[model samples]
Target: MIWTIKKAIYRAMHGSLKVMMVLFNLPEPELFTGAGSSLKIPEVVKSKGINNVLVVTDKVLMELNLLEGLFNSLKENNVEYKVFDDVSENPTIQNVEDGLKLYLEGKCAGIIAFGGGSPMDCAKAIGARAVNPKRSVLVMKGLFKVRRKIPPLFTIPTTAGTGSETTIAAVIKDPDTHEKFAIVDMKLIPIVAALDPELMVGLPPHITSSTGMDALTHAVEAYIGVCGNKLTNENAEKATKLIFENLEEVYKDGLNLEKRNNMALASYYAGVAFTRAGVGYVHAIAHNMGGLYGVPHGLANAVILPYILEFSRKDAEEKLAGLAIAGGIGTPIESNEELSYRFIEKVKAMNKNMGIPSSIKEIQIKDIPLIAERAVKEGNPDYPVPKIMNQKECEGIIRKLLP
Candidate 1:
């Protein structure tokens, strides 16, 4: 069966990679799986012998009283902590600087990225600053130049989007320039990721919907990306299914525990898949738009997903067909093009069902030149994304949403 072959390939790749790591000087992330993952916090901190932790969170988390359980657990374990609730949606360089000041001043042993991606990213930047405070974090933009070993770090994601919890990248927008920059060193990757569905139970419907679409975008990009290995493929496929089946139900009823659990798990798997396989032009472009426009990350991904898929369908047919099948479209389609288009249409329909906007104009449609130009140059350059687009092509993708 296909599932059997996929399972076998995943095992072989994971196994051989580990073997070569010790024998051939290869490197990768420290793999940790957390199904019932809450206790992982204590485990990783204790294992690393981290005596004190600076919990980087945000205002909403502190206001809504969402962090009580985790704080209680840390208190019970005798872990000294400080709270920094200043991180914003698109985290700024100032946010990182302030957080880093707190981290150093508290003399915390490690970091706990205890909120969504913004706080998580702030935590990474704070840790990176701790090691090499003099270096311009902006100068270390693209790959593997994180100069020093950061302190022991852990991430607990309260929402499902952005996956900064498990990824080796942190996106911070410079307040002075209002241009987004990402630091993609392996040092940014967390030591352990804690995915607790209970934490997401408080998410409002709008946040739930947008974050779910973010996960869906991750799977779509990973499945279709050129660098997709067998392991990434399996995770993407399973994550796609989980999102399509559960995202809408949870949107309509945010209190649905089962759907929340499914979305949380899907978000984690999507993070793992995209971390290895790489995201595509949608993400690259979306980042620019978010930085410039103040649009939410997931909302940007949701609005542009179908339009970008339509543009890339011819080049990404086979992979798009795989996603179509995963989304429950059958082989009865007349042609590969038709199948791919149908899948795009299905995503649009899903977005509609979840109350997402049908076009970029809904959130933003400005600074086309800057957004398109920077998209190609940012975030992912190493992986094999399906599309090989130039500036004109990127501009065209932007024009689709223009009024």
Candidate 2:
């Protein structure tokens, strides 16, 4: 009788979940990333029928000339291109405005963003806004405004992080509101994502570590998310395995192209996974933290990953246990609930091993109430939190981390 009742409950719950799944209308970007063939930027440009290209990058990349090889490729293929390497780490609306100015001034047919998330995101906004100046980038937030027939976009990620190349979402800060808003649109998906591990060899250790954590966060969130689809599961598993294997090696030695390649693949896989499944409380809160403080997005995510995962255990125990196994922690002797705790511990250990700090004390969340309120308001609050976090509970969590 008990077993029959349990089965009936399970069926009813799953039936409701299936109903919800059909309603959200998720999106998944087509992924094209790997190593060895990452040097085919010119081929990608040609395939897109691109005549002139605007390469978006950072001033640091320009100084390092990390893109010399790509420039040579453009020259080798007799491809006409303009360089717009003025973007910053966390790009502002003005950056997009400036890049669009250059895009129009050069009258370029396409854009090639050849850097980390900031540059890639900037390029997407510039690409989208260029096609329809009538529709503001801010107004295009949330799902599916990326439909405009913009020029072709080629993204070559220099960092084995961000996975921005593989995601349809572009994050740009609004100066008026000071929020790191996300523009999720299929049209923002790059026409081609060129993955070259050689380009990541120049990344410093700090960046490599932070970005690896970012990749890990994506995988963790996607694997256990409410909207996690089977297709996302396939990619998330690959990302989890690759990140577990290669993140340490890349941190220890950034010049190892093979390790960099694997890490790059991990980031790409996680990006693909989360682009559809969507991230959870960690990302939502981290986004707010980034907006309020000048915290690096990856660092902010890394800091709160374990905390959020611990809180999420109440709702996602089985999912967390699954993550544990994927993260190489076999099922422990305890219940699945305990296994979830083990998973959280393992993640904490991984962060510590990778030199990621535990708290936002570095960013100094002195005003705990303010940070918590903003974290919930700018993030979860009424947006349908996956785990149902109340204000006091959220503030309590933030306060606990302050020691």
lDDT of 2 at 280: 67
Q: Candidate 2 has what TM-score?
A: 0.89
Question: In model 2, which range of ten residues has the least summed lDDT?
Answer: 377-386
> Over the stretch 112-184, how does candidate 1's per-residue lDDT look in tens digits?
8888888998898889888988876676666677899678778888897777777777888887766777787
TM-score, one value per model:
0.88, 0.89
lDDT, each prediction: 0.78, 0.78
lDDT of 1 at 29: 36
Clashing pairs in 1: 226-384
Give me the runs in candidate 1 sitting further than 4 Å from their true place: 1-40, 331-335, 362-366, 379-383
Candidate 2: which pairs clash? Answer: none
Error of 2 at 188 (Å): 0.9
**Whole-model lDDT, candidate 2?**
0.78
